[model samples]
Target: MAKAPVAGGYYPPVGFHFKVEFVGIGNDNDIRFQSVAGLTVEYDTESFKEGGENRFEHKLPLRTKYPDLSLKRGMLTDSKVIKWCLDALQNREFKPAQINVILLNEEHQPLKTWNVYNAWPKKWSVSDLNAQDNSIVIETLELSYNYFTVN
Candidate 1:
């Protein structure tokens, strides 16, 4: 079995970044990513009306703007992960809807990875994380991720 060079442990430079192609279903294959950070997008919201009589009413056909995305994790609060992501997006090496995340630990080894999507924020930004791995501290200076996507 071939072992992944940067898996199961931490890697160096603490602050490492990379990019990967985002392959999705359908004809939207035009999407590509060069880095992982500061990428932005918009979300959609809606409302409805109910009841009647002489006053019962509500607002409809409404729209609002929000940050392209938001990321929150309980593993750590030092902001190192957040800062790294922000810098990657601002580097001008990547694009929206495509990013790669290279997770690392205290020793700077790769931990895990994921593909970012417009709806990914709602899923990853949970209040608390239930990482099943005990080899490293959940909220310690270990276990970091580098996000990016490819074309």
Candidate 2:
């Protein structure tokens, strides 16, 4: 395996970026989700430009300032990201939107999965999104909590 540069373990080689979209979240924890409206991408970057090392923080605004992650304290784990992504794609709990995840491997294979909250967008389409075989594309949504039960 090629040695992937570890930017908090999310692979920050200036190329591993994932373009994502929010479809909506599950019903139980849904809120008015504006975070998953447009196209957003998650990148493993140390700095906004380059050469700096600030770590990869989320670009989109979350509903909760802190997450209720049932863990003591460390760094924001990868599972948290996956959970956040899952929650933001539900319509009943979150605002309505259509979500489509496109995954790309090293060889550049487009693996697609569509998640719809209330409904899928007529205009939001999916196709082969190859990032030049340098990185992988993970489709996910950025969401906020109800602004009340956030820890």
Candidate 3:
């Protein structure tokens, strides 16, 4: 007999149930972000002409490049995360911090994790205020990192 197809796990974890943590900074609520983007690694390539080949040029990877990680959440009046970002952006006091983006299951257990290294805030901005439409003031934090490891 074959086992059941539906098991105790989900095929793909839900994106909305993830958490982002700025290591060694900020309180618990600072980890709650509406969205995390720019978890990307791209290998820069260079091409050169082959000595004898007529139709094709060989390409080689030069280096790996990572784009700035973007994090968005509801604006909070009191937040340590904001202080860190402000210190770097406003005061020019730069400090690197580790960042973790964890994908969670229904039970809140970590399904997968992306550990960002040497992360520092590159930009920060808040959504516009409007009297006509009601919406949460969203704050966005953009971070530049050296690299990331998945686990």
User: So what's the TM-score on candidate 1?
Assistant: 0.24
Better of 1 and 2 by lDDT: 1
Span of ten consecutive residues with least summed lDDT in model 1: 25-34
35-57 per-residue lDDT for model 3 (tens digits): 99999999999999988898999
For model 1, the local distance difference test gives 0.36
Superposed by TM-score, candidate 1 places the C-alpha of residue 86 at a distance from the truth, in angstroms, of 21
lDDT of 1 at 45: 41
* C-alpha lDDT of residue 133 in model 3: 75
List per-prediction Cα lDDT, in the order shown. Answer: 0.36, 0.33, 0.93
Candidate RMSDs in order: 15.5, 17.3, 3.2
lDDT of 2 by residue, 1-151 (tens): 8775866777422223223334343332232121234322333333243346456543443332322111111222344334444444443233334433334455655444323333322221122368676533333333322122100
The TM-score leader among the candidates is: 3
Instruction: Name model 1 segments beyond 4 Å from true.
Output: 1-43, 52-98, 116-151
Q: Which parts of model 2 have CA positions greater than 4 angstroms off?
A: 1-17, 22-95, 112-116, 119-151
